[model samples]
Target: MGKKIILLLTVGVLAAYYVYTPLPDNIEEPWKLTWMIAVSKTVAYLNLFSEFLGANRFVNIAALSKRQEVPPTSDENVTVTDTTFNNIPVRVYVPKRKSVALRRGLFFIHGGGWSSGSFALYPHDFLSRKTAERLDAVVVSASYRKAPKHLFPTQFEDVYNSLKWFLRQDILENYGVDPKRVGVSGSSSGGNLAAAVTQQLTEDPSVKIKLKTQALIYPILQILDMNTPSYRENSHFPTLRKSEVAKGWYDYFTTDRSLENAILLGQLVPAESSHLFKFVNWSSLLPEKFKKGHIYKKPIHGSSDVAKRFPGILDVRAAPLLADDARLRGLPRTYVVTCQYDVLRDDGIMYVTRLQDAGVEVTHNHVDDGYHGAFFLLDLKISHRIINHYIDWLKENL
Candidate 1:
């Protein structure tokens, strides 16, 4: 065991040195050096180190895993209420401050690649109370059923049902909120759910309640094509990657792993889907402006097996960018935030174009120095500067 420990330590040091040396002279803006730091930390936590370092890595992982459950800070004014929304769990945040009548309501969804996140995983009660206090709004963060266990439509249904409950119970009136002033906001995968909920609301007339606006921070708006310029550039980026994003969607929607094989075989969609569906224009609808740093290329055709495995890829809810002109036109005012170095950046840009073209009011903020998962890192002392800027944007817009 002693000899093995020595050998493992030697190999780990060698590998770490190889990965760290010869760094790029100009890594560019939006691509921060901290990303490389995060990669190294991930490696350390994965137990790829030698026996000597194994204990340290295990300790680090344990600390991080534990921190995920720790409360953000001690505050007695913020109260968290855990209750069921359509049989799904949800957390509501109410500030202990005096406010004007009829406060604005914010429906928040937490992000975790659509599978692993929970209501308790986020400091939602804290952040939501802060936002509510500053903006004079009520924030309700829903805990939708995760994927692989609950599937795609299930998560969607859970959120939709929560919204219905919010409306049916006259929550706005009960909480002194103006029904017309309600809004929805989320980050990453939750951002995707927020967009989906908004889209679903556009077609549901039975619900007269209107969503005043939508706040999407680095949202994943499309799924059919993973070959976007950002995807190519950040395919292997830490925290989030094209392959991981694809795998996440597959795992969320199917009970069997064979769906992945079917998607690769082009069997997800029917042979006539090309003509039946408008994926060409939908996928290629990106604006020319965002293409400034992008190199244009013709899209390759998918295999038959690829279509069979993931047939639901064509659904607009799975790929909001594919929604028709009418639906886009009907959507409420939108605020989209994108990060330049993020893989899903182009999706936000293109969706903005589609919304504006469809005659919807749209406001956009592009975070040039940001990465995919940067928004959630705001609470960390080191990342507070950037995360505060995002919060400021939300405050101003909301």
Candidate 2:
């Protein structure tokens, strides 16, 4: 009888903890969503064990799981090499089959919210290899100096310097790459870097080897406002919770934790930038199909206080969404992909709108059933399809 009573107490405690433990805000869904929630919660709980090391160290440590050694190439179809260009480490993939003409080049940047990612990371390593064979292009998978240690523009500078080197006659000749057919592409924060690089190259008179196109897959383009439609709708979405978005930016851009609450409250930019809000404010920018009875709220009025603290947050390279119309004009053709269930969905949509407004040619792909970090789940059938579609668009444009 005593054993039975103990068993009942254990069951009650377990049920109560499962039911009441606060989860990062997420939509209550059935089976698949439940699984996603479970995975996200598990990561969060596991991360708590790293309290002794601090959250930043915890993030870096957790990221180690995503890193694993991958071969340079699968077979003779592609030849791969890991080398540093302008001191930035890169994974280069060259198709073994000789091309009738010089092959197109793809400069790829992997994404891990600007905090963690590498060629060793899955999907990145696999994606780079597959892109070389599928597109018959020389793929340069770039690895930049990571953040919270290296800091903001340092990551940008690494990619920019590598791009300049990649465009050199010696580099192109070695890879049999066509200078005019080069494309820059990246996923998530890497997408943000790709956009910034495109802007820098487009505006620089010294840059002669211009990109033919750029592909941004589920990029985070702005930190100015976090109350967009997607943010509200996907606040609790599994892979990248909306609540974590601004915090990620804070961790990446500044060590000042106090500014986090203000940024989260949408109080970074001054009230004068109100006119600029329309371009990125999702209720007006996102399609009616996405609205679906969703109500729009004006962002809380901002003081320039946080902006003063970290002024680089407002730079065009840091927040391409804030780039002037003139700056965005004459950009290379752009391909943007947004996942339906991703927190950054509106970010991609708003960017497309801004690109179109600036007279840039853009191809937009929306994955209705996709989730944030879905590409990481390459073992899943849907991920394969998403990747194929992305490659198909690249094939058509490049």
Each candidate's clash count = 24, 2
Compose the digit string of candidate 1's lDDT tens values, residues 152-231.
77777888899777765366677667787788888788888889889988889888887888888888876655667777
For model 1, the run of ten residues with the poorest summed lDDT: 21-30
Show where candidate 1 strays beyond 4 Å: 1-67, 70-76, 122-125, 261-271, 275-284, 292-309, 379-397
User: After aligning candidate 1 to the native by TM-score, how far in Å is the CA of 162 from where it should be?
Assistant: 0.9
Q: State which candidate has the highest TM-score.
A: 2
TM-score against truth, every candidate: 0.81, 0.89
Candidate 2: lDDT of 329? 93
* lDDT digits (tens) for residues 90-196 of candidate 2: 98988889789999999998887777778767678788888889999999999887777777888889999998899887889888999889999998999999999
